[model samples]
Target: MKFLRDILDKVKPNFEKDGKLHFLHSTFDAIETFMFVPNHTTKRGAHIRDGIDLKRTMFIVIIALVPCLLFGMWNVGALHYAAQNIDSTLLENMLYGAMKVVPIIVVSYLTGLGIEFAFCQVNGHPVNEGFLVSGMLIPLIVPADIPLWMVIVATAFAVIIGKEVFGGTGMNILNPALTARVFLYIAYPVEMAGEIWVSGIKEGLVDAASGATALGVLGGKDLEAASNYSVNVMDAFMGFIPGSIGETSVLMCLIGAAILIVTGIGSWRIMLATVIGALGMGLILNAVGGNPYYDLPAYQHLLIGGFAFGAVFMATDPVSAAHTTTGKWIYGILIGVLTVLIRVFNPAYPEGIMFAILFMNVMAPLVDNYVVKANIKRRLNRVKA
Candidate 1:
């Protein structure tokens, strides 16, 4: 017992001393002190690390995302049931939905985490839990019926090229989730394109039914309805319409956003800025009497497509997004503007979240550069005065 106590004493720090217990501090301390390298100088004079680490941070995101995920599962089953014209209890429908979505989640996590673990082993560093959120994110952004092998390839590519090659975790330039989506988009154009993907049941197996997405229907419809009222926009907003599994529900995404902001895991500036930018562009189109012109109003933009989901989750990626407050505003606004632009102007892709996020990823560094320079310039001016 004394021997065991001595080992514990050596491995574990006195948390009472610091008044906090950082998630892995004791374990990390043990690994360093006994296993790897002792005398690891605690740099930054940082005392009493918080209980939350990046892993916990990422895990919180996953937890916040649960509502959307559960809703998506139920929705998937609902769509299938509706298509098949079969009587199903809500629970049964949800099970059917889970049958489809769960595998995608499993495959994504397994493949992405496999890569992350290998990299951690090779690099001799502790594993980052960022992929926990990212793995779920990849499937959520993709169509429900995406091929499993494709998921594997995309996950590997995103983890290796999108992240590890640039150096893991905080070093990557592109959002790893977006990276996986982009690779899948380019590599399997037929799969990722909105038209090629199908949500409801197949023709023979179920009752025959066919319906275009609200966006597609609206795009083709006379501009008259857009001006008159919201129309089927409510269905899209509530997530009854067919689209990606998780992204269909703006309300659920907002719930996740609320948690993220409250927890300090995500930036509210980016979230608000994105909504404003999207609304701004949407209102402008309304005023111009353009194709998307409608009395439907600007606020509708927030409920449509993947705008809410992307702004809340994908756009706020700490690694690929702006670190500075000013830079975050700029980055977020551009994403909103670009998302609205793509959704309105491009007839090909109904949702613009993927494009908007990737476009902003490229510009994040420039945004930061200018923000930092402005701060420096102000400091110099102050010194001169």
Candidate 2:
């Protein structure tokens, strides 16, 4: 480590302010800061210096996502082989899935980071670490068979418009990963939707079949008719159902949620509120029971689609989520309710978590403002009393 540090120190002068390679300062600093914590400290103003920097924070999130990524890879391969009735070992499945998934991840990081670094270099600002998490997230949420060119374009759009245009990182209103996902989903619906969720099916080993997802099956018709296409609740819970790479597995999402909660990086209030909101809405729909989809159990909604993944990973983004405690509750509940409403009412789009989260991200500020105003009013009343 010391040898590596010494090498960085030696080459650092070339990337410094008046040096020959000054234009590449952001690139050099990005690598150096990643390898070691910056030693520079606040000298004057009151500041709470801590070991947990933005890089560490983002790295923790990536660590939390590991279980989902690994499981998604295995699931992709397993689904491919299962469709063909080709009995293969777990290792083979994982290896095959990795071949498909890894390239997307690499392209996402390379493209997103390239844009981010370029923006930083051109603007003479320190490189921000927000892309570290967004880069990994974009691949996870999209269909496994999505084109690489789409991923590149979506990533560039996310970094430039969704983030950089809004002043980057902490200033952005929308989650960059979600922004990229929504762009692809809307602009290239053909590629982002339909039977493309699972990879390896194009090998001609299996007969043609409807690649509709579990939620799609449920949303397509009433309960009795849909049961023919419905997956077992246990399968959905364990993630044997077809969907996005990281979103199908409720078990993995819970595991990731636990890591985020234990690390104190994610908001428990928002999570609890989201579940409560969903359950409440589910119960209401069940009682009214106009549609067979509404008759589906409330708890099952939590397991299917991207509800769990969005609640854990996407909705809880510190930058985009509600800041006030009360606002978090309102924001989460709205997301839950909206997700259910959109999924049930809009049959065209079976999954609604992405739209729900992004919509809430837009409304988070309004929620926070109301919460803050109430807090101020309460404080004033107490003083008068």
Candidate 3:
């Protein structure tokens, strides 16, 4: 017993001098300290730090994205099941959707991470956790039928030009995932066009059918001339409407928005302002004898296309979006207004989220500048008074 106690003492870690712990101590430390609030000795300028490291921040983003991803997968399978004229089982449909979406997820992570690691080594900076969130985001925005090689190419372009060229990670002005979508849109118009519909695997007698999204159909025809051009607003809200893989369901997107808002990871102002702006613009367009181009109802415009996705996710990105409280409102409203405007007026592109986000990204710096100037003027007036 004495010998055993001696051996244990010899192996015990010094928790006082170096703050090192062994076994149970280390486990407790990791749980109560590192995960909750780490107490690492800071050698740099900052003395204290919170538990929210980059990894934690990246994880939070992934958590917020969970709703959309799960919904996208289940929706894909459900659509395929519906196409086949079969009875829907939620679990079975999600499993089927997982089979298709998983590959896209894998390809996106491998390619995006490959570029990210190379940049980290070359630039002598630590590997950024940003790509962990971005990789998932890229695959979600793409269509279920998008080719694998195109995904690789788009990932490369988005990482290199959209991020690395701008000095990487937090310095980037545009959302990397949006950059990938834009590249694919311009480079492969045939593949990325709104008309393409995917055929899923058949089970038993259930045969899937090919059809176009309401937005795509509307874009193809003049709404004023076509009596049946109007889309079911409820279907769009419920996410049965055809669009991008993860962008179809407005209901799911709202759930995601709620998670983001509750976690304090997303800006509620941006979300609210964008919706208000879109509805406001839609009402304005409706009042002037209606723009033939935008014959869809105001609420319908919000539910269709990538408007909800953009307003909730892309527009609220901390790095790319406006930082000031007021700037967030202005920026978000502009994104919504532009999204509707582009959808209504621009015949070349049916979906406008990508353009709206990119346009706002460029304007973010200018918006911040004006916001800062206003703050300074207010301070100066206060001093004089």
Each candidate's TM vs. the true structure? 0.84, 0.96, 0.85
Candidate 3 lDDT, 1-385, residue by residue in tens: 5775465446445433354553234333322332333445767685666676777777887887888899888888887778767888999889878987899999999998888767766665656577888898888888876778999999999999999999888999999999999999999997787445443422233232245766676666556543476677788888875556788888888888888888788899999999988998888777764445455678888888888988888888889999999899899899889888888778788887679889998998899899989999999999999
Least accurate 10 contiguous residues by lDDT in model 2: 201-210
- For model 3, what is the error of residue 266's alpha carbon versus the real structure, in angstroms, after optimal superposition? 0.8
Give the root-mean-square deviation of each candidate in angstroms.
6.5, 1.6, 6.6
For residues 1-385, what per-residue lDDT tens digits would candidate 1 score against the true structure?
A: 5775577566466432353554445334434443332443558876886667676798899998998899888887787777667788999978988888999999999999888877776665666566888998988887776778999999999999999999988998999988998898788876675453345533355442243455655554456644443546667678886777898888899899999999999899999999889888888888876454333467877876677889999998888998899999999898888887887777666667789989889889999999999999999999999
Where does candidate 1 have its weakest 10-residue lDDT segment? Answer: 30-39
Off by more than 4 A, model 1: 1-48, 194-211, 219-231, 293-296
By descending lDDT, how would the candidates be arranged? Answer: 2, 3, 1
The list of candidate 3 runs beyond 4 A from truth reads 1-40, 44-46, 198-210, 222-227, 291-293
Clash list (residue pairs), candidate 3: 84-207
lDDT of each: 0.78, 0.88, 0.79
